[model samples]
Target: MPTTQHSPQGHGHAHSLAQGHALDRSEAKDSTENGGEAGNMPNLSTLSLDELKQLDRDPEFFDDFIEEMSVVQHLNEELDSMMNQVENISRENESKGSHLVELKRRLSDDYTALKTLGEKCDQLNKKYLKKSEEYAPQHMRELLQIAASNADADCDRHVEHFLNGKIDVQTFLNTYQSSKKISAERKAKEERLGTQLSALERAGI
Candidate 1:
């Protein structure tokens, strides 16, 4: 007869182990079908601090544990390097954003200034045109009329031949003829001056 062992606790433990294995297999199959990314396993990250403490205190496992210490140190250094790179990139992007805002502000200011300058120039031009229309030809006409009158006065005074003594009929008749010629020339000058004033007034400038 073969001896058989029977214990309720051992049977329960074997059943629990079998169930755990089955659940692990099913989860792995689902993960593979979904092409899931590498994620921390719950069993790994959930290790109790007490469990790690106990392991560290064990003398027989010390050498083996410390053998992997350098690898952990190197991994920490790599993590630090990646974090620095990320921070640097973030700072550069922030600076670029600030620069872009400043440029936009300056451009807006320049556009506003240009618009104001254009409006001012238009107003000044209108003022200049209005003043020019009121003043130019009036001065020119006054100058021309004054010059013609002065010429007439000079001619009338000079025709007498300085006669402070008695004069003959030949001298008086010659002086009268010369005065008549000068009067006609003065009349022509007066007419031409009027014509020039009319032309300047009509032209509006």
Candidate 2:
């Protein structure tokens, strides 16, 4: 029978290769258990070409790397979707804010217009009240009294002229009678107005 033996260097090389494969499998299992977290997975893009080639040569490691890459891609897509939703919400809020501003401005304008209108109405009401007061019963009665006194004075003047012979009897009689009639009518109106005012006062009007 012939004898065969393995060299010491060959034994050491085989042991190192076995250790490298075991380490790679352990890392891959840890990455999978952790749900392929970014920190646990290697960044293949940053790897040198020679390192990538080495990884590609290992079937189990390449498969694990591919799975991790897929998880990263899915995460990136979800993040992009979330960012797009945030942008859309921000745009909607901005539009609502603009509408609110416009509404506020319109309300301010309406308030100012209402205030001006209120002031104008107050001024008109004051003017109307003043005009009404000028034509009140008390003032009208005063005017009527003055008119009656003037008529009486005119009648007296006419009588005097007639006595002085400056006016004829027919003319004096006509003028005096007209003056007396006017005085009587004015006095009657004044008396009637005073009576009505007194009645209103008694009634608390």
Q: CA lDDT of each candidate?
A: 0.70, 0.92
Worst lDDT 10-window in candidate 2: 35-44
lDDT of 2 by residue, 1-205 (tens): 9899899999999999999999999998987788646565667779889879978798887766766775666787899999999999999999999999999999999999999999999999999999898799999999899999999999999999999999999999999999999999999999999999999999999
* lDDT per residue (tens digit) for residues 123-187 in model 1: 99999988786455555445445655665554454444435435565775666666556656655
List TM-score per model, in order. 0.37, 0.53
C-alpha root-mean-square deviation, candidate 2: 9.9
**Where does candidate 1 stray beyond 4 Å?**
1-53, 56-68, 136-194, 197-205
Instruction: Give every collision pair in model 2.
Output: none
Error of 1 at 148 (Å): 19
Each prediction's total of clashing residue pairs, residues at least 3 apart in sequence or on different chains, is: 0, 0
